[model samples]
Target: MNASDRTPADLLSSALAADPGRPLVTFYDDATGERVELSVATFANWVAKTANLLQDELSVEPGDRVALLLPAHWQTAVWLLACASVGVIADVAGDPAAADVAVSGPEPESLQAARACSGARIALALRPLGGRFPQVPEGFTDYAVEVPGQGDRFVPYAPVDPEEPGLIVAGREFSGAEVVERARAEAPELGLTGPGARILSALPYDTWEGLNAGLYGPLATDGSVVLCRNLDRLPGETVDQRIETERVTATAR
Candidate 1:
């Protein structure tokens, strides 16, 4: 299916329909020794709950810009799809002051930027299991606290037009259609072709190239991602070990 009938959310739905048991995202944080693997159904469940949270709690609707101040984690991937599911623009590089909502990591910088958001500010602890921050920041709502209460199945309040702008990845904008088109092109570029292809990517999530590999590339091809943060900290032997352990077929460093 092409962009004419499918959005990124649709692609995910197809993946779930085809093989919900397959792993979609495998995340590793070298800094914290954390590893998380999410299957298509599991990831979709997280996305559904998150989408519900965005729609019901945050009052986010179509065309609303959400500043994503998170990192290269599984939850960030969930939020990206959640935003797409609700027709909200996921702005990875947006200014907090200009955004209607901001979802942030637990870093001081992210917390500070999220606090500056004029609209709803949400903080994610990014712990092993989406744990809440030890000391919740005053200006931000804890995502771990709010998301669990949201419905597991999400239905958008308004239908998302495929031509509507859906993502502001870095400084560039992509409509829902464009995102699917670009993913088709970028998937082969990132060697994320073939069924169940696994890519081990060490790139951060702040740029288009990173986002393409992390989210769109694999999803476009029914492939999976082993996203690595702080790659340089790992020894070369450890990297090789990961390639074997994670069953990675390609490397995108």
Candidate 2:
């Protein structure tokens, strides 16, 4: 399939093939004193492994709802793309009880939701690196434990149709093709131009603007994102410093 006909998964693959070494995601969490940068190839590898865990380990099928009760972090971005790759519908911060599988962070709400889900549950430690949870949450598998052993290359067992459901956020569901079209349609207003557009954003994932920063914008423009968690805590000077350091071209506050 050509670039326009391909899904988000295909967009990522094209980006990787075009420039594997370019930075795709630069993440920072001031609360945890954490910073991580992943290039196209590395991020794609993470998506591959996570997708494998979902399909091979959890037996998640196409059209399955995967609740992502996680905050705005790099791993959360990985999960979003992984779900899209495998044709699983990503429910960002949605109710886990209605989902087929739930991936949560180290938050009470996420924990409670994971426990309530009827299917497999996975909890992320949200450590500086991909570390195992110091104390595993009851009734949920630790994400770090299961992700590493999986293959770095992913080949889906079944085809993921672009017209199928791809994401659900804020009670709104969008198909894979619609997600791309909307992103592309909204790109200019969001300051996402052509290649190499770098946006540094400090927005929560529960809102539509936040999802653009975390997922759609960069994908639409073949650009990069510097995602900040707990950005409200940082000083203006520090934020400016990061903007300079990261070579950010735009900001979404």
Candidate 3:
């Protein structure tokens, strides 16, 4: 399907229709070595709920920017799709100093930068962090415990325009906009679709390359993403084991 012909909602709907019972995401918690999985049906519902909360309760509007400081986990995937569903511009900034909202992990540097970031308004820290997100000095809202419960459905603020910017990624000296324009430009030849197609990505969610090439790209076509913590140091045998276990068909670095 073409970018102009479909919205992010369409992507999720199609995925659910194609394989509602298939696992869409599997997150491994390195701390306790626990595994959590979400089927397509569950993921679709979660995205809908999350989108509703962000749009209705948080007052996030279409084109409004929301940054995610989360690690490469299933929640990060949920947040990305949730933002997309409501036409909110998802800013995947590597450094919190470049973001508006920060979803922090256990990393103190990320937490500290999120607190110091100039434009930040909300900070989301996972429970495992022990609520240690650096105090959002004056003038900021600490959303560590303020997030609303998930709603049943999402009503998009506006129609998604392919030309509109979907995500913003900050570089060392400049930021780049990865709009649906680029997604359209790249989708056809990439074969980013179909049943039994799976993508394994270990890149951080805060990078446009990772978001587009890894997450949205696969979804845009009709595929699922398999997220891993880090692929750099894994032994070759372990890498093969992951691929076999997850039935991953492709990988994006």
Candidate 4:
């Protein structure tokens, strides 16, 4: 059950087995004053449903490329794991035109970019409580609307190979095994030295460093992350207060 030699999906399964109720991802949107927390069980459930949606509804096969044109939101984190579970290569902030599937946020720029994808297109409203968009975007399935109808459990039709490409961030491709290895390697440097280390990250998800700090590093250590978006909008005092309130032991900014 150790994450050292396993894929991201295996790591998640191990985390769920270790403690389903433990908080895994705690997200904050400083601009919108939004905060949402997901326990390991809840996060895994979302990943399963999203993986089912990708596999059953979208018909995504192993090695398919999925462009993730989203920010560092909680739902975005779920999508990363779902892509891993379904054996799809997640291209974060990649060109939608070249992808087999594209996932976009509700922002106008992301929506505009997602329209180029000839394959399946999905959109997230990124609303509190995972609410659906008031009006679904053109040619895009609403994730919040579709995911809930999917089954709670997921099993990939094709087993995920750890050596297969799993993630692409900033145009750097990494296999499923490399993703886990990189996460583990970056954990200590990112101050995720021990289990239960709470890390507060203000970095964007577009870079390897950001992904490591915001998602993978903490996960590798069986720790939790306080992921912040638009953190620069908040005052220094407010940010400090949040660190104290969240019991953050480390910072990656």
- Candidate 2: list runs displaced more than 4 Å: none
Candidate 2 has an lDDT of: 0.88
Ranking by lDDT: 4, 1, 2, 3
Q: Model 4, stretches more than 4 Å misplaced?
A: 1-5
Q: For model 3, what is the alpha-carbon lDDT of residue 224?
A: 69
Of models 1 and 4, which has the larger TM-score? 4
TM-score of each: 0.97, 0.97, 0.75, 0.98
On TM-score, the stronger of 1 and 3 is 1
Candidate 2 lDDT, 21-138, residue by residue in tens: 9999999998988999999999999999999999999999999999999888899989999999999999988888899998999888769868889999999999988899888999
Model 3 TM-score relative to the real fold: 0.75
What residue pairs clash in candidate 3, if any at all?
69-103
Clashing pairs in 1: none
| lDDT for model 3 | 0.63
lDDT of 3 by residue, 1-253 (tens): 3333455566776777667897777655545554667888888877887787677667777776676767777767777778777776666654556554555554566566567556535545543422534655344455444444556666676776544555556542111124444544565444555655677777776665666555666766666677776566677898789889988887766
Tens-place lDDT digits, model 1, residues 8-97: 888888888889999999999999999999999999999999999999988988999999998888999999999999999999958988
lDDT of each: 0.89, 0.88, 0.63, 0.93
Give candidate 1's root-mean-square deviation (CA, Å).
Answer: 1.2
The stretch of ten residues in a row with the least summed lDDT in candidate 4 is: 1-10
Lowest-scoring 10 consecutive residues by lDDT in candidate 3? Answer: 172-181
TM-score (C-alpha) between model 1 and the true structure? 0.97
- C-alpha positional error of residue 108 in candidate 1 after TM-score superposition, expressed in Å: 1.0
Displacement of residue 189 (Cα, Å) in model 4 is 0.7
